[model samples]
Target: MVGTAAQHFVAVHGVGHGAWVYYKVKPRMEAAGVRFTPVSLAAAGNNGKKLEEVRSLHDYTTPLLEVLAAVPAGEKVVLVGHSGGGYPAAYAMEKFPEKISVAVFVNALMPDTKNRPSYVIDEYLARTPPEAWMDTQFPTYGDPPITALVVGPKFISDSLYNLSPVEDQALGHLSVRPGSLFMEDLATMDKFSDDKFGSVRRAYIVAADDKTIPAEFQRWLIENNPVAEVKEIKGADHMPMFTQPDALCKCLLEIAQKHAA
Candidate 1:
């Protein structure tokens, strides 16, 4: 077991999921002697909040920010983000960079300062819902000014999880909901840009067979941020919590240890 700067691991899950989805990883981290703090975004997880209420990147990140602010002074944390959750993690880095000791992008968008989280959705927009349904229905569920139906969770293709086990695949199915806007406002924050991220010590865990975010894209993200370190988890799907707990645990611990050192 490795000790982290703080006992807790603050995690934000990908689309359709709240903090509960991290249960598998949470216990493993705790058994290994690290602490875990899993939270839900406004409309995420079992928070029971309606999907439409969480319409913007900031609304989704407010819970995470509250947690970061509560951390013990002088204590640092490694923020772990999965899939769409990257938007909030990136924002957290911007609002409170000092609270984050490191960032781990897990099959999620890795946006540097200049790049927008919206770009992640842009890559898939063409394949998402037809314009009519998206343009009309989404606005009813999600307010305007948000890129909900098309860019947020709506555009995720089932192919992203071709490698996961049956159970995780189902959970992914259940958690699906359109995010308010696909990219995050955090991308616009002063210190969260490409040059700034390059200055922070970062690390990434690349899923060997992730189609959701692609190994190539993960590599591209790491390459763009010069300060980041990379580790490969073999035979892992995009959702490591379900498909590869042990390997994911090892990666998490290794990341924690490096930052701890």
Candidate 2:
């Protein structure tokens, strides 16, 4: 259990997911005296913006940046990034290292400071070919052809929500939106610096049974971008908050106690 000092946690959802995905996590963390804030990036969750409106990486990360900017000067918050949310989390760490106590990548992409921000995602796509996506649509938009991923119900059920509850799977099907990879923008942007992003503490929570990002690939990510520590949740699918909420909470609480103290 965490000490009397309350730890603040800001959760960033992955592609197609909104802040609503953290509904199960919020109460559990808050009950343990942690301040939990889940944010919806542009066009995600209930955000009014259309996918077409999000033109660049900066636009997609604006909400998260705003939230970090609002944090008290002396205090820091734990930033939890799930799946593709890792991109913005890394971005935040670079932009506001002092405001973040630690960054936790939960079955998510963990980019290294040595390469462009797009490198990790590009690697991920290379590993997961179009055929492997299985019904998940990759539609390109705009003049330069920015690609957006629309996760299909079949893919969500078979991969993302395999171990989650029926109700949760239903919720995901109804709420998910098209999410951009912003590959073009990231490819041109500068790489993260060791002085900023690397200075912040990082921990990874691996969902052992995650089929979306297979165990082997997850290990590959860890090997490439080593974190301060690595924790695993046995039998957890991609959406651990739904399938393994208690276990996820335990890992998060332990991380908070160790890293945020």
Candidate 3:
């Protein structure tokens, strides 16, 4: 395990999820004397922004970028992203690599800019049948864009929260919101370069039993975009923050201590 600076830790959530997903593990970081900021992407969580308002990738990620900017120069933070949060985390690393000590992807998308945003969703849908996704809906590509993606209640428990507590699953159903897929923006974006995003050190946390991004796909991502080290926790679903908080906390602290500095 690599060691990191033990100062600040920033976390970003996946699609249809807010910072609330990290609530279970935040306390562990706090107890360890690390500063933790769990961000809600655009319209997700208590951001109060409407789904229609997130028109561009810039709007969707401004909050995360802003937080990265707030870190004092000469001081670096350990940046962590889950699922859809990985894309923005990659973008942030590209934009401000100096501020990030390390970027950690926890069962999240490991974007290379070679793969378009649509590829992420399409891959999931390709491997998973329509029934597995339940009533999850996507926006139509047209003049008046649908703007947001919404995962259904049944889909939440079935695919995402299968290993989580029943009450925690209920909280997810009640608080989930419409989220952007950023397909249009990613389609037009340039591929990440070695001098930019690839310069930053990275790590991957594999949820072995992940239903959303299966174990094979997770390894596929790791093979595509290599990381400094790889860690695994078996029986963990896509939402390990809830199902494996203690294990996740230990993994993160190890990452921060080994890779962040």
Candidate 4:
């Protein structure tokens, strides 16, 4: 009923990725009559900002915040986050719970008030060879090493884009930038109350074949943070937008319709 006609969606891309990641899904959502806005967080994907410029959790997520703030009053939006994009979605939910009708995590990190993005990242990094898969340090910040983490192309194909088309996977490796880890920023801004973020309805779309976040970890995240519903995209890797846009779009629409006013 409420969403039977149309609904608005603001999709956020994961770490190292920019608005470009949502390219494949945007046209499909449009064809389906869903309004879609794909955003590239600061210092990410054609944003023209360098990774070194990102110094805080807020800095890393400013673009997403800007987009949410631009939403008109009394108008609610469905916030969707993929991979590392989940942190911003959660932060936005906490900051503007009233504006978000529902938050969706798509094969992404689901950090709670008690959790931090650094902790979630560490879990994934532990499973891979840091030297080979990522850039552990750069001259971005001083003293404590506030460098961004960059994913290697080899790693992307194996873990994040295994199920995607060869050309799409290549584009992913070439286009992805180094994402700000913002370990310190998240450590400080990680606190959220149940009345804020918890009050917003949440959903998770699990990439059943994800090697980046992994299906088990996605389930673990849900168990800890909890959500109203769970959907699965079978055979999808971490980048389902490219590997399974149709299914992902359908799932997103289903969530919107199920929770529509």
Candidate 5:
């Protein structure tokens, strides 16, 4: 029931990234008269929480859930999740379906109600083996051994920011933080429901040239859990906000118009 003037876009970043990932697209979205809010997940970006502090999926998703909880009555937000960020976004969608106009997964791990929340992450890991992680670091913390992935410069350059500018690539190398998939917590968590998460409209944006989550895997995600619409950013890599901001912004604006309004 969001009014046309109340169109809001909430962006959720992927692993090892924070709200900063959407810096390139934020201005563009706002210029189009859309309110854009980019959130920093626990331990990511400038968030003070340490990697060990975010032990579970709930811990990591607190910020986003809080944001949705604060939305005014009768207003809704267009939630966009990129990369591994789709997990938290999906969790929020399940928790606050009425607050979201649509859930857009941009080359992200979109989940289904049939499987555990971690299924998409498990499938992604299976598709991309540990060896494929390249120099990415997997550091464990806490008594239970919570693991977090710190993207290495090589991995950033080759897989994530391949199509981005050298400056933006360097920015990613400098600012990216350790992020956990929280697979254990997700495995134990209840599955998303058709009435909650499924009630919200869903869309997928394919980053065509992404090496991190290849086009094939992206397609597989779509095939597995169908969405209301599928959008593609041709020649874009995993970091489409940096590599193809114009196209990414265009798609988002159009999506907001169609779905949020």
Candidate 6:
């Protein structure tokens, strides 16, 4: 296990959470003596931007890239991505392989190293069973990078969402809403991959109650991505940042430790 003291973690929000989701999360890790940094996409968090305003992957990466640039040349960071945040985190990994310490994919929509972001949801569109998790189409807002879709528990049901805590839903904090079309298409080319990237230490946390992207889908994501550890979180749904901050924090800390070793 990575020693508890003096570890650095980068917290990335999937869809809605800007850097603020860590407000509840950072303290727990700090209490444990961990140093973590939380980042928001261009319009996410308190940025005064709307989801519709994001036009491309670059927009989604704005906040995260700032963090990456701030890192010293030789220092690598432990990446924690929630929801769509995985894309840019992966992109960052590809661009700055040496800068990344490890990766932690939460109840996140994970993409393949070479695939476009679309592939994560493409499987469901092609699923024989068909996914009832979403509405007719994703909710339309301003210019968007990836389609920011929010598939809440009501649409997906308790079984898939059983892992999510009710308190998370009550907070109504995660509402970034990922768009499937343009965002998924971004994953098609591995423009970011180089020798340094594509093989960083990686982990995935499966949310048992996640209706938005069920465990089965999460499994597929992990299988396609290059992951070293896969942690299953029971009774927590799609938004663990709200429902189970400590659980998320613990998983992140563990993954960072594993990579450090």
Please provide TM-scores, in order, for all candidate models, with all chains considered together.
Answer: 0.81, 0.97, 0.92, 0.91, 0.96, 0.81
Identify the candidate with maximal TM-score. 2
Candidate 4: list runs displaced more than 4 Å. 1-6, 115-119, 122-144
After superposition of all CA atoms, the RMSD between model 2 and the true structure is 1.1
Pairs that collide in candidate 5 are none
Candidate 4 residue-wise lDDT, 194-240, digit = tens: 89888999999999998777798899888877899999999799899
Quote the RMSD, in angstroms, for model 4: 2.5
By descending lDDT, how would the candidates be arranged?
Answer: 2, 5, 3, 4, 1, 6
Local distance difference test values of all predictions, in order: 0.67, 0.90, 0.82, 0.81, 0.89, 0.67
Better of 2 and 5 by lDDT: 2
Instruction: Report the Cα lDDT for residue 239, model 2.
Output: 92
lDDT of 2 by residue, 1-261 (tens): 542346889999999899999999888888878788999999999888998889897899899999999998999999999999988899899999999988999999888998888898888888886776888988998887888999999999988999989999999999999998788899999999999999999999999999898877888999998988899999899998999887888898898788887
lDDT of 6: 0.67
Q: What stretches of model 5 exceed 4 Å from their correct place?
A: 1-4
What lDDT tens digits, residue by residue, belong to model 1 across residues 1-261?
A: 556534567889876567877878888888888877887876777766776666567777888889999988887777888877776887778777777778887766666655555555565444444542322234435334444432332323345456667676666666755445434443343445543343445677888787556677677666765445678887877777777888888887888787645
Model 5 C-alpha lDDT per residue in residues 150-247, reported as the tens digit of each score: 88889999889988999999999899988989987888888899999989999999999999999999999999999988999998999999999989
Badly placed stretches (over 4 Å) of model 6 are 1-4, 114-117, 128-131, 134-167, 173-181, 184-196
lDDT of 6 by residue, 205-233 (tens): 99877766677888888777757888887
Q: Show where candidate 1 strays beyond 4 Å.
A: 4-6, 116-145, 149-158, 181-199
Clashing pairs in 4: none
Q: Could you say which candidate leads in lDDT?
A: 2
Which ranges in model 3 have alpha carbons more than 4 Å from their true place?
A: 1-6, 113-122, 141-147
